[model samples]
Target: MLIERPEANAGTTGREREMKDIIIVGGGYVGLSVAVAVKKAAPHLEIELMEAAPEHVWQKDERASAIIAAAINMLKTLELWDDIKDDAQPINDMIVTDSKTGEPVKPVFLTFADRAATNEPFAYMIPNVSMVRALRQKADELGITIRHGAAVTAFENNGGHAKITLAGGEEIATRLVVACDGVRSRLRYMAGIKTVKFDYGQSGIVTTVAHERPHNGRAEEHFLPAGPFAILPLKGNRSSLVWTERTDDAKRLVESDDMVFEVELERRFGHHLGKLELAGGRRAFPLGLTLSRAFIAPRLALAGDAAHGIHPISGQGLNLGFKDVAALAETIVEADRMGLDIGAMDTLERYQSWRRFDTVRMGMTTDVLNRLFSNDIGPLRVARDFGLGVVDRMPGLKRYFIEEAAGRTMHDKPKLLAGEPL
Candidate 1:
């Protein structure tokens, strides 16, 4: 059945009279993925995407994300991997160490050879701009309407359909509204979804560095007193850094002069990569764990950061969003194919159930890890290091950890995440 948009002041007597099938708020990776995934599977559904930022804003993002294998599979299914592959750097192995900031010798307590059995990288470091560019292109090809600078200010879930008012007083009605605005999503609040949030009192300073030597596709996580400092490999001799520190110290470092910043950075970064030069701009992001109390409310569904925002210590924040994309897209598409209301409470519950546990589990896991490792307690450090060493020696256990991190061992994954058409 073809659904048409109703004119202003149009009265809808039934759910079938909705103005649009779905209206997605926010045009980030998650929002675009939801639109592309649903439309490709169910072409009859009418979807419109709105971004509050100006056009081409995504192009200015210099950050990169660690995309796990399952998400890479989804991108392949969406026909986006081809455009994103060249810019992506694979992680063949990773090592973790718990040590002081200026330790002369940082013993690696745990090491993971991710590709020993699978013969494939567990994750890839993808530039944010590259990923968004490909998604926008795919959205365009799918004929999905994307509007920038269109901020939605008010939202109401009518019994028949949801009505949203933009900043300019323009109203649009749809059967479903998907919120991907961000961790601080206004849409989620508008839908009355509360979140369980915790501030870690830490911040991650992100920047790219050009090293004198190649990384050999190995990533490292050094657990310092302040927090985890992750060295994620990228294409060429450049690597991205997520240096965690106290909020006050993080702000100071970013604002510090280049000489002082690099001096402090080298103390934690080590000389393994030889001399390092700042290859990209630096910025600091406060670290926190935010889990939405509910994923759905009537005609509203929250995905990505809107639903759950976890600490970046594990690098699973964005991957979790991709998981939501897979699950929610599958739910909506499958419900529509069965001739059921896609925005119906029961239909949306399936998505919630599928994603809620995983989101909460990850949220708690990161919170615990950040609290445990981001300290200098002698006994605690010794106990955690002992645990890491034990896990490192057990080949089977290490393999399990690698597979889990790669997102290949999880059960009940959606078809899209398994590289199949939805």
Candidate 2:
């Protein structure tokens, strides 16, 4: 029912006469990873990526993400870890505290020191630019065609393949389509896949700060009345902060003068780290949870934030996307090896079922954590603090949490996540 334009075959051979094997939409870490992973494993597959932004846009991202141990294994398997390791700062220790914003002395409800037990840091904070750079380099090495400034204007599933129309009116025919676009994905909407979404009425203010004293790779999460204030260590004396506050308050603060902003920041970010200075620009992102009802539709599959967008309370948002990359990549590669239709309903279902439970579970977990902590109700505060203290005292329970956070306790993990290649 769909026709491929003559211009679409300009550079094609007999193998690419009608359609590309896979077309991944989005150019973020997750989208690029999917392209690299599948192309690396199955060199015969004709793959291309369509990015809506310009070629150099990703380099402008000033944000950083917390990468867990399991995701590190996948990056190593992709041979990207070496390029990123130098810029990555390990999370050697983490402590949790519950107190008011101006509390002089806050009691530590829980502390986790897991590097000794795991023989590796639980996670690392890696800049977005570094991760994207490595992935783009690898994608080029794999001969994956990445088209920038090409946004999807239309998408159609033609039973056997998919036809995607670009904003420039160019048409692409592909055996499969993978959408790794962000939470508000146009591809997901085009697929008619509904989502269960909830706005938290809060925004996370993200910025980098340079302090006089070193953090020693320690991270802290201070649960205050508004929401969680997280201090995640970066390289040197720099730390990235995810400060949650009411929506209106966050907007005013981000727009406020530097002096007023820093004053309020100092009130929450104690003096333990000595004087703090703004290391980079600040931005506020609205907090929300969005989970697609289905991960697959016809010959299309969704990955990354396109599939699930969870709150940052547990710092697992990007890590969750990495997990999707690992699972979905393995599924596609294995199906190709078996000479099965990689975009067939059965094939995509395997990936959907494999990822659905984990996605929903994480979404619910973050939701509960946000609701339970982002309040000043005295009774609730006392109960949650007691719970944290109890968990901290139980060594075995604490170990389980560390293992889970490091992604070591997951069952039936993909080969890439476990550091194995297809």
Candidate 3:
């Protein structure tokens, strides 16, 4: 638990408790981004962020996330893109294939060229650690207080303010609390917000691999009988892999010896990339769809996985969280400028209204895509493959799909997402 206070404001008596305008729980991508964005928009607001893990642990996260075009715009608006741009690997193209495991040949069904009219790639693959590091540095520059190793044990919404108790007995009062604590968020439960959840009976095995040959900025998604296996390009000849399998099979593969794991990996990963070697450790995450019934209650609001969790089949989970960050920050900043209570139910509802429908739409789309592709039913496979082939043949349709994947669809885009300042 976080037991130290900020050095500049240390040594305060019991009567001089520090009160903040906003306190964000969880210091992951969503949480940190929200904190930084809000502080950027409204510098006068006192913001504090709490994380359950130690400060050093965030830098150790080896996972990679796909940042869609809209999220890239949001980062640029936050003035953070320049710091991490060199570490991002743009996805230039994508190929989709369908085949059963151990099949001698996998047939390509569809392909997408990611370059839009502006000659920009639709998305980029960035390391989670790098993104968090940049956001933390920006937050420090803005004087947003961050308490690592701090977990909110409980919270109470007493009409206008939220009283939060930390695990180490520190009590904080804030006008609003944003929960970005993830899919199984404790704060969401404490706020009495229920969720609609469905387990997919599958697990995603994630790791990085270095290949002898370059990927040439290409991404590949091979739809095997179990699930989709994605090879996303990273810096150099390395690529991030998201391999899906039956939960039991996934656990077994991850727990297997290096040689056994490599053998299984090579079976799905074609030799086109040449010699393959594991570039990082492996981890398996259970697949599921979780959506909160309400995004706001009293002085609390949900963001990121705390609000919605969708399948990673479309690689939109992190992008969706970034959408939440943009919307919530815009809402709070606008409310503050209008001299209204940012934490009020009316103010928070606007944010909910802005994001909830889009969240559900993406969640359902991924759910349907996972079900459609992660099976071996003969007739369904034939029909879906035919559909993919048809989409592949139409240039205009493919471009439209690429734009949608780039998050260029018609919707109530927040200012930050549109690369505008609040």
Candidate 4:
């Protein structure tokens, strides 16, 4: 039997402690969101988030996240949606165009984002910095320890709890551990979990551009033979662009001079919103799909990009992380109510079961879309565009697609994802 330590009286009346320390690995979107969700479910739980970097590296890029509807509701539950909502640009509509030489072959108007609000937006274009700031601030208020410049160099899971050794030589003992450390998670490897992943022969180039005319809160996507060129609306007359191109060409673009890059960008970005002048810095990321073969190992579990990585054709990276947070939080909370060990493989498997399929499905969906739309085949283009047109005209089908993009699909949503933590 394990021995319990007695609580010390700290100059106050008798009140038992409520929190049990839980160590979280990494401080990215996934790591921080998991901490927030866990604390929201059980306010008394002690949570510590570790980040190896001194400052959040996410600030290096000027890209923004297309906040899905479900993720917005999650921010609401954490009392943070109101804070960053104003900085966001709601995607009221989306336009798809073809880069083919002939006249318009494929043109479909998308109204999925309006589902996020009954009549408002299906999703909002919130900058990476804003979301990171908001999550960091919320962590402070929720009493979640934010440990910057900290790394878990080594760890041990004794089938019951995880003991982590930090780079600074400090040690932490926690009953539960969540690995939100991105696709290159050492914790997952150390836990002896294998991963399945494949790299797409493409690279995503992210940057911000200022247009001559207002986007009017509208987004645009250009389907080129090379890959998808997505322009999500941003505040003012600026928009964030995610251009997926051949890996070799992407390398050249990243290294191209400002003038050379601008000319190439103009070709990819038509003059719908008028002249597009490059703004912010440009960065490229090789595309891939990575999923942990097994999500739960003993007292440890994985979430966010650490659990899975997918193509960004649909802007679902952070949203997927939030989904992981919601499901895991619910499972742990429900287990708490049942008076069971929240970190046990049996209990953690509930979260794994609840989320793995969706991750796989989404990863596959993005992969399929990238391949189907990235090719120059005329027949396939005609077919895919025809499919888009058909869906756009079908209200029921359109509504269903809209709701799914909004993250309101009822089929596999967990309790916390539905805006009520169990």
Cα lDDT listed for each candidate: 0.92, 0.91, 0.91, 0.79
Model 1 lDDT per residue over 102-189, tens place: 8978999999865835688989999999999999999999999999999999999887679888888777888899999999999999
Measure candidate 1: CA RMSD. Answer: 2.6
Clashes of each: 0, 0, 0, 3
Q: What is the C-alpha RMSD of each candidate to the true structure, in Å?
A: 2.6, 3.2, 4.2, 4.5
Instruction: Evaluate residue 168 in candidate 3 and report its C-alpha lDDT on the 0 to 100 scale.
Output: 73
lDDT of 4 by residue, 312-391 (tens): 88888888888888888888777766777777778888888888888889988988998898888988877888887777
With candidate 2 superimposed using the best TM-score fit, by how many Å does residue 302's alpha carbon deviate from the native?
0.5
Q: Quick one: how many clashes does candidate 1 have?
A: 0
What TM-score, to 2 decimals, does candidate 2 have?
0.96
Residues 1-422, candidate 2: write the lDDT tens digits: 22233355654444334578899999999999999988988998899999999999888888899999999999999999999999999999999999999898989999997673559998999999999999999999999999999899889988767788888677777879999989999999999999999999999999999999999999999999999999999999999999999999999999999999999999999999999999999999999999999999998999999999988999999998999999999999888877777888898999999999999999999999999999999999999999999999999999889988988887789999899997
Per-residue lDDT of model 3, residues 293-388, tens digit only: 999999899999999999999999999999999999999999888888888899999999999999999999999999999999999999999999
**Candidate 3 residue spans exceeding 4 A from truth:** 1-16
